[model samples]
Target: MHTSAANELKSESLELLREYYQFPSAELRNRLVQLNLGLVRKEAHHWVNQCTESYEDLLQVGCMGLIRAIERFDIAKGHAFSSFAIPYIRGEIQHYLRDKGSPVRIPRRWQTLQHQATMLTRQLQVQLNRQPTDQEIAAALEISVAEWQEIKLAFRNRAPLSLDAPMHEDDDSSASLADLVPDNRYQSFQLAQEDRIRLQQALVQLEKRTREVLEFVFLYDLTQKETAERLGISAVTVSRRVKSGLKLLKKIMVGSSS
Candidate 1:
């Protein structure tokens, strides 16, 4: 934004905040959120290079924080709204990344423990002439078994594995995470059955003559001449009914879904 536009917006925001402080209506709150949306976008942009989460997702989460800040802000305190609101926006995105295992926001204490655990493992390997078990590690660290387990689990799961990651470590193996996922036949069968039920329901909505014509031609897999003979109608009439009935069924199905 240009300097002049920034000044104008700051001026506008000040007046709106003063008005909102006194009136406290939904309309004023909405306007305040709109005027300050740039704050959310700015905070979200700061996280774009730091994590794998999409910018739009970060922006959406930051907007929630911005809304909370606006609702609780005290204009009487003389604090700059930008300064006050930035923490809320930044904290929300940090929390989202932490929960999503972005690995940057791991607690300082846990990070320290993880480092200690790594060093301790190498020492114990030489002393015992073998890898230390979880129990031995926890005892050596003077922490509970559960705490040691948690630390190990968090460190292991902190980063997402790409779907392109190899499923085998062999030099010539071509398998990947994507290839390991099972696409079973039962799920496909269920989807097909659901579609058949929908088609049957749509068929029931047709007029009696039209329904009979469709059932004979489609369900029985009969030719138009055979369908017409069964229905006692000319082949031309059967063709017309089939076309009109299909168009109406398409419309009815679309309307029902909507």
Candidate 2:
């Protein structure tokens, strides 16, 4: 169907749904799905581009989520149905990708965590007007620091760097960076779960200022100058504190492992 026709159908369906939403009526439910099927197709297109698979399979999976969303939607919520339905549709597609669409399938649990992490990162990024620290995001989500690290790892797994894409230099004719770069995950860890927990525990033992300095430096990837500016301290102090915190964190991690 044409874009205009799909949009018109969506608008008409939403209007009907807003006025009369009957749970048991097959006709009403069917109409809503038929109209909103376009949404599923649209969202599936996004994944299909990234994924090497037939679009039809993903479209079918996304439609299942759209149907479920229609069944569960509450008109009284006073929210746009499109906004609410997109997540459901996206989640379904991602879940399907994790299961069968991708060669290296991640577990369903990690997939859900990664999805939550992405949404929370966006939310906190907007609220803070800068990238949020893992500590801040963890506090807001009320998840353990280790769990947040796991989410980050899971998110990284989904990110694929193209071998044909240029890396550093702007020159397009240069050799692709993939030849020089090794995609190794086993070297140390992209931050192991054990390390995170030990580090979190060590953080609690540090002085408040020391903990804050480390948070700014590592979690937010702030430089000594930026940390000093934000915390109203000298660069020397931020440097000293970060140095001390790292020493302590390293000791704690080693202790925990032993």
Candidate 3:
């Protein structure tokens, strides 16, 4: 609420932070967090321009940064907490913005490679006096040609997108990229064969009527009424069959799992 300025109490606050390490109390930790809100505000101001999120949201993220910094700070390191905590605070905000800003959730491995390859390319270009070749880039980055190609794809997907209305007020275009692009859902790389086997075993145990209901309701994605009409049964009968089938199916699966 009314914290002493971080600058004014640098030494005193550092001591308070070390005290936090000893006692490990949330009240003290929160008090330290309040005192260090200035750091969060300062870092939030710096990132406000680069990020598309509202300044208020950025500040909230920055406060998360501050809290993390407080949690991880070590008094035994003998460095100023400001110097130590700045990276954690900045990193927290950057990480939050990175996730918030990206339309695609790029895998962590690729994210690391993106940084590595970008940094490597810049260094190689300067060192070699030209743009690096795929061979040269791969060699320096210690990745094979196929891996390098996948890295290239990841770099493309990781590019930033703006949430602002796609078409400008003056534009007459009917379709934006959102209209043009198809959303891709993530697919598991492999089916669990054992699980599939277990499911089949479970399905085999269902009664003929119940299995038929399940097949129509799920495999064909038919409504209960439609399934009933197709099966020459009342909708209530179809509903009962489906309910009983799922219950039996769950029992079989649970037994199999155990």
Clash pairs of candidate 2?
A: none
Which lDDT tens digits does candidate 1 get at residues 142-250?
A: 8999888766655543443233333122242343222322236534322222233345545666888998876666544455765676567887788777667766777
lDDT (C-alpha) at residue 59 in model 2: 91
Question: Backbone clash tally for model 2?
Answer: 0
RMSD of 3: 22.1
Per-candidate TM vs. native? 0.39, 0.40, 0.38
RMSD of each: 24.5, 18.4, 22.1
For each candidate, what is the lDDT?
A: 0.68, 0.63, 0.61
Tens digits of per-residue lDDT for model 3, 163-217: 1122222133232222212224312312133333344445555767787777556
In model 1, where do residues sit more than 4 Å from their true spots? 105-258
Instruction: Give per-residue lDDT, candidate 2, residue 60.
Output: 89
RMSD of 1: 24.5
Worst 10 residues of 3 by lDDT: 161-170
